[model samples]
Target: MDTGPETGTGTSEQTTSQSARPGYKQLLRTADAWTFLLPGFAARQPFAMLTIGIVLLVQHTTGSYGSAGVVSAATGVSMALFAPQSGKLADRFGQGAVLLPGVLVHTAAIAALISLALAHAPLWALLAAAVPAGASVPQVGPMVRSRWAVKLNGSPLMSTAAAFESVTDEFTFVVGPVLATALCTSVHPAAGLVAEAALTLVGGLLFAAQRRTAPVPSRLAGGGTRHASALTVPGVRVLAIVFLGIGSVFGGMQVSLTAFTQAIGEPGINGLLYGTFAAGNMCAGVVCGAIAWKVTPQRRLLVAYPLLTLACSTLWAVHAVPLLGALGLLVGLCIAPSLITGYTLVESLVPAAARTEAFTWLTGAVALGQAAAATVSGQLADRFGASAGFLVPLGGTALALATLLTLRRRLSTTRQDG
Candidate 1:
């Protein structure tokens, strides 16, 4: 298998190609790569909206941030728990087979949750509706990464693909939250979720229809034997844990920023503030992808992870909106390299057949961590104020960094393809 500079295990051919430092234009020109990328981007945008949309709508109805956070946490927890199973099914069958029904169910579920929230139903009823809403979230991001893995396998361009996809994901975050926040604040409290459902329906169907680009099912590809879960891999586990911490930054920021804006009688600024943070991530992704790095992905991750912790440590101390926006941007800037490096590392760490599942495990880890953090941060914000909620990202990253440090050696043992 061809490896890039990331693994430092590439053959001379890989080294020769790596010497030129492939760009995004080269990556996009690869055999209709843009076909799936566009629809996949639309399909995945709803994910960025789900938690924040839930929080916004529920908070508006319940008049309690804690309740809002709990409802959103329910959705996140269900998604994190069920997403891997969805990926496993996609791997065994095909992405289209899994995604078609997943999207339909997700749209219906989101509708139900929105109705339940609008009706001021009991928390139990809302939680019940949220379960399927999240559980059925189409695994578009993971599926897209799997598509790229198939398209660019054994090429130096795989790292470029990884970086590009991370940028796409970050870009969606930039657009999704701002759009959701705008729809909710300007239109109606439930407008964000309404748009989320509509997009999931339209975008999900469009993405699923592009079946030609889908990766081959593992069983059809002659890997019919029962494969263990990707989480069984120690390296995957470590990466998942690290991703969970990264998710905390997202969750904490969403709730804390909202509370901060609300506390200052400027509730509409939530989207702009969050957008600035996500913009930082997108900018860094562009820069990270454009660079021709000599360092291994593992080393890059080590350096980037610490910087994320350091950047997040200061978020709790700032009350000024301008400073908060600037600091949030800095925190955002620190995130993309870690995310890009982690995805790049997946190339050498897992076999081709289980690639989608591996991606989902990391994705699900982010959801789970975000869910837990949203719950904790919401409670903290409700009691102690928005500043207290910011602490979640700092503490979460610190713990994750420590774990990555101790288990750092496991990441070096890449899978040896024969």
Candidate 2:
């Protein structure tokens, strides 16, 4: 029942002990934390690879960006629909019980998709394979965050942990795409997906094996009543919507960048450019986590959302490849701080019983946004060219900003014991 201080109140209660704010060296010394973190981090590598991998693989085989978009979107749609159910199962059972089976099914599905794509199977077959591939994606990120919540509960280190996870996510996105692109372009279009399947199996097993840190199933205090769904939680609903917008920005950027590079005769460089975008987020996330903020998480989000909107809007005008890369880096600056704060707020809002499910809802929103953005952006790129597709992210950013403004008051109610 110990939540940290309410953010953005500008009071001494919001501050933490000096010792709680450990340096990077001291942070790593928490060996048990890393044991839980590393495997999940490895598992996440495939998340970044899958969407782009499908795009590249299908596009190469069918020679149509729209087909590639639909195939990739199918995965997102499946993940979006099924992620919450998986998380709820993890919460009811345990990480290992859910993840082991999930990983097996997910890996097998990805393999099937790869085989189908390599053989130039019908588009419907490829799309059908994507369903189980995505639906069975182990909820690694949410599970890890939930573990952090349990491990760091009632401590100031919660913010630091959130920042670390956010940075880890950015880092994975940075490397995953580059690695996938290299494997696809140099080896074969299916190489990236094959590698993703391998990583999922290895990392999922390693992460699930750490039973000591896994969260115990929730039980009511005085009775055996079940907890309400995370969907019914007020703040969770708001944040999920916001996350949807953020996901759209990311999805649109990825698909548009691919089309742009392909148009400019540098399809191979798409990963590098995407890495540049994530590089900015990684660097900022490191700094954001290290520093103690005086403002509430809501205040930080208010500022960060507008900045993201402005940054994404600028992409609409970017024509030159080098300038676009630079703009991508600039646009990435606010992403980490926003996400770090958003997750922290989500932590404050939901009770421990529904923590994993709540976090998974956030991830589901992102997947939903990605599903919509990939299809829409790809269509725009095909019809109006790549730069024109930037409008999708721009529109998403604007809508996110509006959502925040509308819900600002509700989000500001972040108390330590909510």
Candidate 3:
């Protein structure tokens, strides 16, 4: 079956070029890549919006920050557990097959979560639904990237695609939290969750129906006996560790900000604070996007990681109301680009056959990190205060950078030999 956006093409075709692919800059200006990607970017927004909105809704409902933390943690946990499985499913049948199902499952779960909250159901029940939700969360990032890569034939356009995804993500994050918070604060607290569910389901379906951008199903579902063993591959293993570290930092950043808000006597500003951080990330993404050059993925990471480390660790210097949040904003600017760079590197490093599974591994790593931070960071905040809670993630970020630096020698040598 024709699965990509160009459904009329009848079959998935391999049209890769032996010629040099366009640079990252020119890809953005190119008509084809943008046509495929722009819609994909638009499709991704609702997913982020709902995810953020629902988390806030659940957090507000339970009133126990711990319960809220657990519900949010469930999302990370579910996504971690199912990401590889979901990716494998994507690889096999088609990304569209997996995408729609995941979105539906997620939408249903969100509805259940809202209903559970309204019915005053136990937190335990809500947590159960969250598992399914996480398990089915959208594969948008990986799916879209994979399509772009295949479509663009390994062009520098891939980096531009990565930048586009990151930037779009930042845009979603910025709008998602603000809109979610605003909706939740309204007389109809339930409206936000419903809107999220609807958007996710509709968006997911719309994306799946867009044949131009979907993946061609190879004998993927039943034909190739590919490995869960992809997990065992050396480069993937290394990348997984990097993801784990980075995920911890991202997850920990959220928990820290939440804790920080409370500690500074302005818990109400939490959404706005996150929105600020997202704004900075969005700005960074735009800058990254405008640059048409492709710096080696490793070089980008090497430069970006240290900046992440520095920004994350330095927020403690402020004694002002919004200044701390402002510093946090500064810190977050490079975060999405760094992540985009990392994912781009991962995609470049992994084999095509293993792409979906590889992306899953990254998602799982992220989920694991977020869940752990939510579980631990909160308690740490309870004990030593929010500022101290942050130190753990900052330290983790530094350690991750160190690990990456240590591996740089081997990695650089390997890439050159190839």
Candidate 4:
């Protein structure tokens, strides 16, 4: 059966000799593609919805933004701390092995959280539970990307897959937070919590079930100690810095949205404002996918980084109500394409056995950066001005853009992406 993902037009018999060579359509049309990807899409809906629910639930329950922030930070920190090891594990024992542990841990964490809330446990205990819970982050999207890239014989299907993932990710973030916000405010917040638990269980399980899409373990690790090496590699380092800027812009934007909405006493407006940002990103990513760039991956970054920089920098001027949304939309427009490009490039540059670890490193970097950004942005908004807080991200985005330009010459393409 043909998978839902479409292929280009079929070739004439004259092209029959070329059948030995596979294209993206054929690869994506395979059983492995639909089995992995469709489930992945189904899984994303709740994945995003649950995460946003957790944040909102905890924040509302504790009535302390600091505690909420720490819990949120813990999730990122745990992911950052464990992703490399988890990724390496995926490389060693196949992606499915690590996924089981990750999801169980994640499910337990959410369940533990609900249980603690019912038991009225202290904040410290809550934090303790969260630490273990965060560690269970299933390496879903990255593993799928790597799996598909190999499935497609390393054709440009990788780019298409990345674009497809980006679009879904953007959609998930957009709808997830809004739905979570609504659920948290409704007559029952616990229902949202329960829903989150179910998702982590089902989504995590379905993803792990598709053995065909799991990475084939290598005899030896392609690269040693990705957590250490990702920082050392020039290209990884450059991309890491870009992720830092992305984290700051996104993290600060999140906090700012909440603050602004709460300030106006229409607290739910945060979802609306943030949704616009996601819409911009989705549109931007689709546009990028449509534009076929002959430029090298590194060169693509050269062009994209500046656009991303300008997008974030533009937020500094967002004092006007309409302009605030416009600036956010502009930033969103540039954000996903740049991120998708950078990540796709990273996938190509890193070795196959190390691909999982490499992606984890990238996710961790962005998460860590966002964690730091959230803490700092909260303080800045409290002390100086809410409007002025955007300057920090503006400056950071500029710095990231500069770093990418400086290292553009040394950037390496992932042989797999070739």
Give the candidate number with the greatest lDDT: 1
Task: Kindly list the per-residue Cα lDDT of model 3 for residues 108-206, writing each as its tens digit.
Answer: 888888888777689889888778877777767677777766665455556666777677777887887667666776646677667767767777776
Badly placed stretches (over 4 Å) of model 4 are: 1-31, 115-123, 187-192, 219-233, 314-321, 382-389, 414-418
**Candidate 3, superposed: residue stretches over 4 Å from native:** 1-25, 28-39, 220-229, 262-268, 292-295, 316-319, 409-418
RMSD of 3: 4.1
TM-score for predicted model 4 compared with the true structure = 0.85
Tens-digit per-residue lDDT, 1-418, candidate 2: 4232122221332233225564454455543678787888888889989999999999999988888889999999899999999888887777788999999999999999999998999999999999999899888999999987776664566677788888998998899989999999999999999999999999999999988777776542314557778777677777887888888888898899999999999998999999999898899999988887788888898899899888888897888989999999987787888888888887777777778898899888888888789989989998999888788888987887898889777774554222
TM-score of 3: 0.85
Candidate 4 per-residue lDDT over residues 1-418, each given as its tens digit: 1111223322221133135233334435544468888777656566455444555666667764545556666666776677767876776677778877777778888788877755767778777876776677676766777666555434555566677667777787678767667777674655666776677678878988887556666533333333234444567767877887887776667666665666567776667777788789888877666555576667676777788777776675565556787888888887887788877776667666566677777766766666666556555665665565567667777877887777776567634321
User: RMSD, each candidate, Å?
Assistant: 3.8, 4.4, 4.1, 5.2
User: So what's the TM-score on candidate 2?
Assistant: 0.93
What does the lDDT read for residue 220 in candidate 2? 20
Pick out the ten consecutive residues of candidate 2 with the lowest summed lDDT: 4-13
TM-score of each: 0.95, 0.93, 0.85, 0.85
lDDT of 3 at 415: 22
Task: Give residue 323's error in model 2 in angstroms.
Answer: 0.7
In model 2, the Cα lDDT at residue 379 comes to: 90
